[model samples]
Structures are given as C-alpha cells and as structure tokens.
Target: MAVIEYQHSAEDITPAQLNGFFVGWPNPPTPDVHLRLLRNSDAVMLAVDTETRQVVGFITAITDGVLAAYIPFLEVLPAYQHQGIGQTLVRRMLERLQDLYMIDLLCDTDIQSFYEPLGMYRAVGMCARNFARQSGQ
Candidate 1:
C-alpha cells in the first residue's frame, strides 16, 4: 500500500473519498454527515490513501481551546486497520491538543492498550448514549 497523505484541513474533501468508514457501526453516519461533523469539529486529522486518494481513516475532536477537549470520533477503514494508521492519527491529534489541560475520548475496552502506548492513561469516565443519534440524522 502507498503511504497515506495526511492533511489537517477539511478543504477539498469530497463524499466519494469518504466511503467504507463506520466499520462495525450498526447506525453509522453517512459520508455527507461525516463531512459536516469534521467541518464542525475544533480540530481534525485525515489519513488519505495515497494510491486511491480515498479517506481511509480520520479522527476528530471538539475543544474549548483552553481547558478541555473531547474526541468524538476515530475511524480506520477495515481494510486498513492494524497498519499503525490509527495510532498515528491519534498521536497527531493529541499533539494538536496538547496545550489543553484535559483530553478525553471514549472507546471500547479492548482498545485501551492502543492508546496507552501513546501516553494516554486509563481513566474512568461516564457517558450516555442515545442509540438513535448514532446516525447523526
């Protein structure tokens, strides 16, 4: 696979490049909505497949720009998982938010180790989910 081209901006990103994301999500957001979310976020990191020019992975965070930040999404296309792309995306986004006092994210228990190596520690957090909102419709 060709090396991914990483860009910090949401410009020039089309719906066609955003296919095949939301893996394992029963009610994942559509590409158009996904673009809206990214555009609305405080910061974003995109991993574009160099060969196909598709968006294979991405991470987004909303922040107060002073005290705290919350990562709302991180996704890597199934075909591109285990290739260190996810880790790199997270690391880069964290660096972007390093000036803040708190950076938080919610993820499956199994993925804890993935973030631990990137200087993130285990923490207890509470969350509420409205399953209906998963589609962002």
Candidate 2:
C-alpha cells in the first residue's frame, strides 16, 4: 500500500488524476465526467495515492443541508479494493455529515455487511436507474 491521502475538497484535482474507477460498469463515466461529478457533488471525499498522484477511491453525497443526506457513490479502484481505502472514505464522509439527521445509501445486499460494521443498518428503499444515461451525459 502506497501513501494514501484523504481529501474533502476537489481542489487541484484534474481529469488526468481520475482513472481506473467505475470498474465493471458497461458505460462507466470517463475521467472528465468523473471529475465534473466530483466537482458538482455537495460533498466529496477522495482517497489518493500519494506516490502515483491518482485518485484511487471516492465517495459522494447529496444533501438538503439541514437534515437529509444521501450517499450516491462510493468506489475504489479494482486494484485498491481491499486496502481499507473505501472504508476510510466512508468513515470520513459520515463524520462530515454527522450533523445531519439522516444519512442514507443504497447498496447491494452482498455489500451491506461491509457497511454494517461501519455503523450502517439494514433499511428498505427503492431506486430507479437509467442505464442509457449512466455515463453521465
């Protein structure tokens, strides 16, 4: 594991530094689109590899700023998946949102266990996806 720096803001970040993410998606966002979303997000936490100077993991949240917050994305590069980067990003994001009354995210059942130990609980929710626009056009 190389030196990892966690950042809350997208300052100094560029599309070149964002690659190898959105793994396994058929129509994943390009690095440029990724950077745009990061910049637009209400809150963002990034895990960067100091040596490579690349973003290896990131989490984003959308919030009403008073009480409700929703985590829309959390991803780590495939090579960095098991290195605790994802966990650290989530923990930091949660801390940043501690003042909110609700912090929610929707993840697959298999991945629920991962978030559970980090203080998340099971919940019923509904979501809709438009794969045609998944690449963030």
Candidate 3:
C-alpha cells in the first residue's frame, strides 16, 4: 500500500494531480474546474498518495461557520476505493465542522450504510441539480 497523506488545503495543488475522479458522472468537472472547486469550497480534505503525488480522494464542504454545513462531494479514485481513504476523508471533514449545529450530506440509499458507522444518520432532504453545469464550467 502506498503511503497516504491527508491535507486540508489545496494551496499548491495543480490540475494534473486531480485526475480520475467523478467516476460515473456524465459531465464530470475537468481537472482545472476541480481545482477551482477545491479552492472555492469552505473546507476540503484530500487523501494523497505521497509516493506518486496524486490526489486519490477528496471531500468538500460548504459551511456557514456557525450553524450548518453541507458536504457536497466525497469521492475516491476508482483504484483507491475500498482502502479506507473515503472513510477517513469523511471523518476528517466532519471533525472540522463539528462546531456547527448541523452537518449534512446527501447520498444514495446504497451508500448510507457506509456512513452510519461514522456517526452520520439518515435524514430526509431535497436537492436540485442543473446537469448542464455539472462540469462547473
């Protein structure tokens, strides 16, 4: 197993290092857009492979700093999935937002079990997406 490093900032990150995410999205963001997304997010946690200097996984949060936080993305590269990176990312992000009154994320039913062990509970929520802008162009 490669040495994995977790970081909370994207300061020196580049587009090339962000390849291979958003696995099944029809219009995944390009690397540059991904970089922008990371920078724009209120908080981000990244799992990087120290040996290859590649970002293998990431979770992004949008927070109001006091009351609520919404996790919009949590993804691991296909090759890196099932390696505990995703769980670690979520845990770290949650810790960072622990002071908030609410921390929320929406995921499919199939993945809800993956989060239950991490202290997240199932909740009803609604979302609206504009697929045309999914790439964050």
Candidate 4:
C-alpha cells in the first residue's frame, strides 16, 4: 500500500495533479475547472498519494457560514478506491463542518451506507442539475 497524505487546503495543487477524477461523469469538469471549484469551495479535503504526488480523492463543501453547509462532491480515483481514502476525506470534511447546524449531502442509495457509518443520516432532499453546467464552466 502506498502512503496517503490528507490535506485540508488546495493551495499548491495544480491541474496536472488533479487528473483521473470525476470517474464516470459524462461531462466532468476539466482539471482547470476542478481546481477553480476547489478554490471557490468553503472547505475541501484532499487525499494525495505520497509517492505520485497526485490527488487521488477529494471532498468539497459550500456553506452559509452560519447555519448550513452542503457537501457537493466526494470522489476517489478509480485506481485508488477501496483504500479508505474516500472515507477519510468525508470524515475530515464533516469534522470541519461540525460546528454548523446542518451538514447535508445527496448520495445514491447504494452509497448511503458509506456515510451512515460516518454519522450521517438519510433524508429527503431535492436538487436541480443543469447538464450544460455540470462541467462547472
């Protein structure tokens, strides 16, 4: 197993280091836009492979800074999955939002178990996605 380092900031990250994420999205954001989103998010957690210096996983959240925060993204590179990186990313991001009144995210039913273990619960929610803007242009 390779050494994995978790970082709370995206300060020195580059597009090249962010390759291979957003695995199955038909219109995934380009690395440039990915970095831009990371920069714009209220908080982010990254799981980096120490040997390759690549960002293998990340979680991003947006917050009102007073009452609520929504986690919009959590992804792990295909090659790096099942190694606990995703769990670490989510846990760290949740901890960062622990003080907030509400911390929420929407995930598929299959993945709900993943968050349940981390203290998150299932809830009804609605979302609108503009496929054209899915790439976060």
What local lDDT does model 4 show for residue 122? 92
Judged by lDDT relative to the true structure, which candidate is superior, 1 or 3? 3
TM-score of each: 0.96, 0.97, 0.98, 0.97
- Highest lDDT against the true fold, candidate: 3
The CA lDDT of each predicted structure is: 0.91, 0.93, 0.94, 0.92
Rank candidates, lDDT, best first.
3, 2, 4, 1
Candidate 4 accuracy as lDDT: 0.92
Candidate 1 error regions (>4 Å): none
Which stretches of model 2 miss by more than 4 angstroms? none
Stretches of model 3 off by over 4 angstroms after superposition: none
**Candidate 3, residue 94: how far the Cα is off, in Å:** 0.8
- Per-residue C-alpha lDDT of model 4 across residues 25-83, encoded as one tens digit per residue: 89999999999999899999999999999999999999999999999999998888898
lDDT of model number 3: 0.94
Q: Which ten residues in a row have the lowest lDDT in candidate 2?
A: 76-85
Look at candidate 1 and give me any clashing residue pairs. none
The 10-residue segment of model 4 with minimum total lDDT is: 128-137
**Candidate 2 residue-wise lDDT, 6-93, digit = tens:** 9998878999999888878999999989999999999999999999999999999999999999999999988888989999999999
